[model samples]
Target: MGVGGNFWDLLKPYGHKEGFDFLRNKRVAVDLSFWIVQHENAIKTHVRKPHLRLTFFRTINLFSKFGAFPVFVVDGKPSPLKSQARTARYFRSSGIELASLPVPEEGASAERNSLFSTYVQECVELVQLLGMPVLKARGEAEALCAQLNSEGHVDACLTADSDAFLFGAKCIIKCFCPNSKEPFECYNMSDIEAGLGLKRRHLIAISLLVGNDHDMNGVRGIGLDTALHFVKAFSEDDILNRLCEIGKGNASQFQINIKSEDNIEMDGNSPHKKQLHCSFCGHPGSKRDHMKFSCGYCAKKDDDEGCLRKPEDFKCDCFSCGMNRRQKEQKRLENWHTKICQKIAEEPNFPKDEIIDMYLCNDNGYFSANDGPHTVWGKPNIEMLIDFLNFHQHWDPSYIRRMMFPMMSTIFLRDMASTPAESLLFGQYEFDSLERVKMRYGYQFYVVKWKRAGGNIAFKVPSKESGTQDVAVELDETVNLLDDCDVPEIHQDDECSFLLTDENMDLVGAAFPAEVKRFWQEQELKDLKKRKNSASKSQENESPASSSARSIQLNITEFYTSTKVKHQPKQEESSKNNDSGDSNMKRNESSSSNLPKSVRRRLLFD
Candidate 1:
């Protein structure tokens, strides 16, 4: 049998007994539920790392020295059906303002209490060293640990609570030893039964009648003594029959607690009956809509709450509504899309370039894309799309906000085709133009649209090989430049006042010496000169190149569309080729390193 708790301290009294040596090799399975619970709090307090070094990790080190191995099992999230009462208690204890629900503080007192239930890092390290598989039950981690013992995978279940008894583990070792104590006390289920003068079934019934500490609905007014009487006298059939009768008699009242006011036996056979069931499917699951409990099928089908079902006699996948439910989902999605489009339209800061591009081109690249049968990019708003990118370095959120403008509009239409017409349609723009723009804005080319007359179209295309490496570096350079510049304090419309401010224009002109700099500075000064004359609005000056040209550059080596091979001149055995006129002619025919000055400037900056 596995030995746990302060076994070392307890066994100290029974030292060196032959065969009792099995205690050393017992391979004790320690319940890590408390560890996880405590860890969540420790991590918040910044004591988790230290705790790992001292407690769990230290145990591993100590055990290794003695040639003993221990396995630790962590507690998982509370099961929906099993822990509803406990959850309700926690929620009540939190006393959080309803408003805090939307913006819960990171380390709120409630979270700290919950984290206290999470085991620290050392538990993780200890498990890794032991090479034991970590098991997670469908709903509760603790239940799985108890089940492991029940199934005989573990010699015995070790835990701080008595809940494991409900799972029917043969033996449980509670508080075996925390630090050090003699007799290293452990209470077997049989011993508990003997002490209480009740059978195992009676014990389970009492637990159920009283309600589990985690989640249970205690039959009101059914005290332990009254419950004990029924457990001793009634058979399973008798108890179930009475329960059904009582339930039916009160069916019209829409509640089941009246009969529960009279004490009766508790049974473990159907511990789940009192808990919440799927309203549509009648499945005995809790938190079906919370956190990780989402139904993948329902999510994939349509992300609406109505798709989740519960019925009294629920069976099979479809809820009571069946096909009608599906039809409703389709209508819901259409309505949702309309509202989303309207919201985007109202947001002034939304990238106009991206919006215009998506609207003009029949592609959903800025929002979503479908790549053949298996893959699909989910739709997202401009902020969501931009935030999806992984940044290499810390960046100001505002700079990224600005670049998301034109970047959002550029759609990736379709995969490149070798045919001339197709190439001209999708791949006509120099790859450099595309790469430089994306690099500067931290955008992935989402998808391209087919230039159809109507309807949304999109195609996936991989970035071209030649310009791929430069994208990251160029983007980083642009970010660095933006970081150095002083951000304009005024809004986009107050451009004239901002430009005329000597301090502001000094910074702006130094960053970009192009057309934008000249226009803003010249107008700012001119408008300020004559207070008597009406404020003259200068004609809108257009920059020959778009705003993107501020950071764009071209590589000369990539100017050629295709590679042309030239034969290498064979070296002469003698000094003849070195001295020969033909060799000189071949050398002169090769490409030149230096280009015309205007050509060099154009390639570098144009």
Candidate 2:
């Protein structure tokens, strides 16, 4: 399924840390297929229901609790080249003939594949419900996960597939030992390169030679050890040429049995004739035309006899064409060669820059990197997650809150304020000094005056409202002089009592002059009272009007209910009036009819 066992043997074991500790505050990209396959036996049931839902739920929950943000990547459509291996595995596992399997229609849905069963769908749904992202890859999920990690979209990839290394994954967490006290197994790219003495290119080459889903059985007689040796011995360019030569030599060994009716005879006299056989059309000829190797059958004009027109026209009785067996084999070999060439020539097709841009862009919604209170990683959506765990998972809200507070504060403060650590001490007034303080609704707010600019700035001791007490204590410890400041306790309505100082005033070395502090304190109290009185008056004016409207509606409803008198007389009087009006209109029409046509027209005009 991946690189052979010998390749894995070369990988050195990285030292362990507890799974929770190692993954804490990390963004991990998970290969969904690997997870599903790893838990296949435990999750699958006879009734076709996946019992693994709970396992997946608990696994993701554990990651979240440890502060690991996981992005689940599911496999999309399988590569066309992988179909043979998939089909072979299906036949072996299901014990059904490959012919019995439904042929994949053109543009068939990716979900129609056997690998993505209802159980996998259920797992994907569970991940989505947990507010985690599930990215459906364009091709292989492992490749996508590797890309995500390599590009810094995630800190590491969680995949057992060894091929992820070849895909350029910097770090791989092979498996999660959630129940074990020890940390999970992980591999680093640096370690892999050092231990194996192979770069990414070499790893890919080894996989191809050792046999993979794309190239089954690899080169005959070549095993993992031989492949490793070959890769180490040859440069990338040299390895590709060597592989091509080996493929051509192997193809030449197959004897071409020409049919009597085809008039193509094997020339035993010519040494090169045996090697010139057209592996497709069975036409033997010279191996070189104009110093280029040319398959005569493929080069033949359409009008020429025995020239293969379409892929379907290759049907013949020759050894290469019997039931299309050799045709399929030939195609497979060509595909392998093409892929090898591409790997050697081109870079890995990963949208690394695009993914980085997406993460760095400040966007609102799920999967946004900058969605939290600060731009630092893992701070966004934390509150929503804490709430979810507290209510749904029945976790103690206080415990969860306590666990996240310090981590969040450290990252938030590091990002939000770039104030140097030394400057945090009030005793060191090189840049700024604590000018004034006010306590409002259990929060201690202070004003800092920058000495150089004489600019005043306000700051709260505890930034977050929920954990004010702890943050306040931490602030006091950080700035010991805060305890000496005479902070006045003010009511809730007096929150904005701190005033901006004069722009030109210079108090570079003065430590909160008593006279200036007293002046601001008196002015702050007067402003607070004024604001409170105006706020009360606005509320009182709004409340009386609303109350009067409610009373008027109630009175109207009561009057209507009490006055239910009969309306028969009103209906009778209205009917009589209608009859009189109709009679009067008829009399007017009779009077107009008696007049002359011109006179009636003039009267109507008048």
Candidate 3:
């Protein structure tokens, strides 16, 4: 979807795995359309309305798991060049023979937008309900995402598009992998520049030489490696300009530093002459001389008879041969570069100005430095979200809330951290107690219990002056249908009974420091008490028996050392059965006939 010729592979070396909290408290711009369409395309056949499902879960994970404030950007009007490229891509992927396939009419070419628009719209709606900000790009979604990042409106762009680098993204998260310990495959422009010496313009130039989303076929003969080699020859500032010049058949003026091995260069006046070599060893000197005094390469201990046999793909290593080889390679590359530049020159539009403009243009006015794109992450519309998912996904409100709890709790904890106070979680559940501390993936969390908030409590008192009963008037407990199946059951005499849930340890420490400290102190006391009790028990066992004159402590096993000795209980039972003239089986059968049918069935199963 970005630069072709396996551009991501070229950048793979620079990408690094980032932890779940890498984007904590940072604003990230997401290529909303690509995020949905690319993923849904993979599992769309097996998963129904995967876009909506993915969007829902992804938003929750990006927000709650990574703690990133995600701003989703949908595509506005795509550029005409992009439209043409997309059409071509669709045709190529349709599995139809291009020559046999009828040339378009609108009906012939399947528009990619038409296929994914409905789903993308549904995703956009779901994201909005989740309370993330959504923006429309002036052209491509990654363009706006990159703009937001470049302008410092967002900390990073969440996109897989390699062209996001060309579009001037400082940092990009390619995507998240659910199965990975470090989920985010993050790329920093600084790392790329430090490692590959490629800046934004250099990447743009590579995209021009290789290929990109908008320009599918770059230079006919050039690929990622060729583009990298060609791009490195020029400075970042003039890289794009050089590409334009090369596309105009002016590459001859561009000086290329093809470093010769050991700084060797052949002068026309001193052309490298082919050297004589030993036929057996493929090294310098005549074969006759080598047979008498072994060649340097062949003699390991200066006593070897024949030269070590040359390998199947061996080449002569003489100085003259190496020099000549370099000369030929230099000439070949010069010719190859010339041919590639000619191919660029032959193309209708060399370095497509629109694409260069698209990448370089920092502000498309839709998102700008003046009044930057809105990246504010708002409070989620819970009710709206419930209704939306219920209608589109057929998910029960209870299920939605359960799924939404992580995101909801995260937001709640943040508020509590800033203004420490007693509050209901999600305005429905109240914090009960901290159950225990749990660890996962090297992260500490507090297992906290939450119970349904009692609307029956927290009521205004009746006025005493009015002669009304002194008790405060109360409202009946609000029975919510959504919570009927999900709400924790309260047992007799226990007001706030509920299951424990894992809460971020850091958030809990900040929001409820006193409680956490108290919990630790109590745990320490309990552990100390346990240790003291065990120590006392051990001392009691080890101490001499009180008031015992001569107590014998004998080991029964030492007294009875014989192995394989059986007890006489079986023989005694046979004698008893013989005396009674009735078997134990008959007695059991009589008792079973009196027992219940259910018990008999249970016995059969047992």
Q: Write the per-residue lDDT of candidate 2 for residues 438-544, one digit (tens) a residue.
A: 44223333444332223222333323444322212222121111011222222122232322221111221133345456656777998999999999988986897
lDDT agreement with native, every candidate: 0.36, 0.50, 0.73
Against the correct fold, how does model 2 do in TM-score?
Answer: 0.41
Greater-TM-score candidate between 1 and 3:
3
Report clash pairs, candidate 3: none
Query: Candidate 3: lDDT of 131?
Result: 82
Cα lDDT tens digits, model 1, 328-432, are 454554454334334333433322232122112322111122431111222114343223221221223344332221211112111221111223222222111
**Winner of 2 and 3 under TM-score:** 3
lDDT by residue for model 3 over 1-606, one digit each (tens)? 799999888889999988756788889888887667555544455434667766777788677766788898888776667776776777789976555634444423233556578888888888988888899877778888887888788999988888888888899988665544576789999999999998888898888878888878887877788889777877888878877887777878865656565776544335556878878778888888887777787776655466676788998776787778888877776777677677778877788897898888876546446666666677889999988876776665665676777777788888889997777777778766788887744567687776666542222223445433211222123211111111222322254346455677888788778888999999999999999999998887767773131233234454355333544676667657674335666677888999999999999899
Q: What is the TM-score of each candidate against the true structure?
A: 0.32, 0.41, 0.74
TM-score of 3: 0.74
Best by TM-score: 3
Sort by TM-score, best first. Answer: 3, 2, 1
Best by lDDT: 3
Q: Model 3 — which ten-residue stretch has the worst lDDT?
A: 479-488
